[model samples]
Target: MTTVVHEFDWPDRVVIGTVGRPGERTFYLQARAGKRTASIAMEKEQSAVLAEMIDRMLDELVTADDKLSIPAEAPAELLDDAPLDQPVEEEFRTGSMRLGWDPRTAQMVIEAFPVEEEIPGSDDEALDVAAETESEPSEMLVVRIPVGTARAFAERARRVVASGRPTCSDCGMPMDEGHECAPEADA
Candidate 1:
């Protein structure tokens, strides 16, 4: 089967956004350039981790090379606070993701693969399936953005992840309208 690669090089916009209420929201990683768009569903934890990882990577790059033009924070001009584009259609559910830096272009590359369905069989059969699918993924999203835009993207992602349902101070669990905090037992 032919793999579909939704690639966006220097895209006009890319972001993590959600729909529905805080506690019942559905996270999506959307990328767009001109009239083309690709939206992929992702878990809330995935979005948070992706943002954190990007920030950490950028920080390390700054420390490693003082001469590099990496910024300490997202530039004001690059800040994106707008809601996601209309007609948010989910193309796929994200499974594994890869993030990397392209020194040649000074861009951060993000690749997201579709969730692989488990084949019910023995361990050996699973290994065989893995080997067969290793070379080709059914579909993937590949986005490449500059450092400044990457910073902006990361910042927006962090905000979106944090905009979820408030957490209970007692149990550190998400609190809804009818949530009850569980008491902790003394050690």
Candidate 2:
């Protein structure tokens, strides 16, 4: 199997932003390294999960070493509604994501796996496809951002997620414009 890796070492900017209104928002992660830039599409859930993971990691790092200046929240002045760069075609739709600390490079590595769409029907056919595809390596997007920027990105992402439509108190699901929840459904 061939492995294709796209790496951005010490990106100048890495941020998560949305393209539409609360309920219909499309989250994207854009990283700029040197002259090349990469923008990837991810679900809102993925963004929230990534932000939560980053936040937890930053907290752990700060706790482990009191010297790290990772703040709980980014400075308000630093947060802005920056638009995604031109040619915003998604490099890939994120299927899975991971975060790691590289001691050798002293940088945090964020890797995102491309979404794999499976054709559903017969189990045998699915296994055959999976086996066939197993020989082909999937593309992964990797970015290394500064700790401060990572923290800021997490904070901004948290805000963006919270800014979504209000949730139904009973079912704990997002409420649409005319969302109706039945007492039985709540249970």
Candidate 3:
């Protein structure tokens, strides 16, 4: 099958957002440029990790010899707190992602691939069947943003990930309305 790439370069907006309540939220990575938009469903962990990795990448760029104008923090003007665009249609569920830096353009590139559809069969049969088929994604989302926008995107992604269910102070696990913490262990 031919892969459809939703490419966005120097996008007008890109962010990680959620739908539903705190404990039952579904995370999505959305990118928009002009009238074109692409949204992909992802796990909360993925969103958090993406933000962290972006931050780490930017931090490393700050110390590089290239002396590119990397920002120490997201510029106030670029901080985007707006909710995701209307009609947030998910193109696919993300299975894997790749991140890279383009030195020539001073841009961060993000590519997300869809999860492979599972074949109906036993484990061994599934593996055999999968091997017969082409091992490539049918669709992908490619987004490129400048350094400052990348910083802002990372910051907002982190906030969205953290906005989920509050954690138990004692157990360090997510807590619902009636969640109870385990007692402290004796030294």
Give the alpha-carbon lDDT of every model: 0.91, 0.80, 0.90
lDDT of 1: 0.91
lDDT tens readout by residue for model 3, 1-187: 6789999999999999988899898899999989998999999999989999999999998887467889889998999898888888999999999999998999999999998887777799768878677566789999999999999999999989888788888898899878888778899
lDDT of 2: 0.80
Question: On a 0 to 1 TM-score scale, where does candidate 2 land against the true structure?
Answer: 0.81
Error of 1 at 85 (Å): 0.9
Choose the strongest candidate by lDDT: 1
With a 3 Å backbone cut-off (N, CA, C), the pairs that clash in candidate 3 are none
Query: Pairing residues by index, what is the TM-score of model 1?
Result: 0.91
Give the lDDT of residue 103 in candidate 3.
89
Give the 10-residue window scoring lowest on summed lDDT in candidate 3: 128-137
- Per-residue accuracy of model 2 over 55-120 as CA lDDT, tens digit each: 889888888978666667776666656777776777788888889987565567899988876656
Runs of candidate 1 exceeding 4 Å displacement:
120-134, 185-187
Error of 2 at 86 (Å): 3.2
Query: How big is the RMSD of model 2?
Result: 3.3
Candidate structures ordered by lDDT, highest first: 1, 3, 2
Query: Which has the better lDDT: candidate 1, or candidate 2?
Result: 1
- Model 2 is weakest, by summed lDDT over 10 consecutive residues, at 178-187
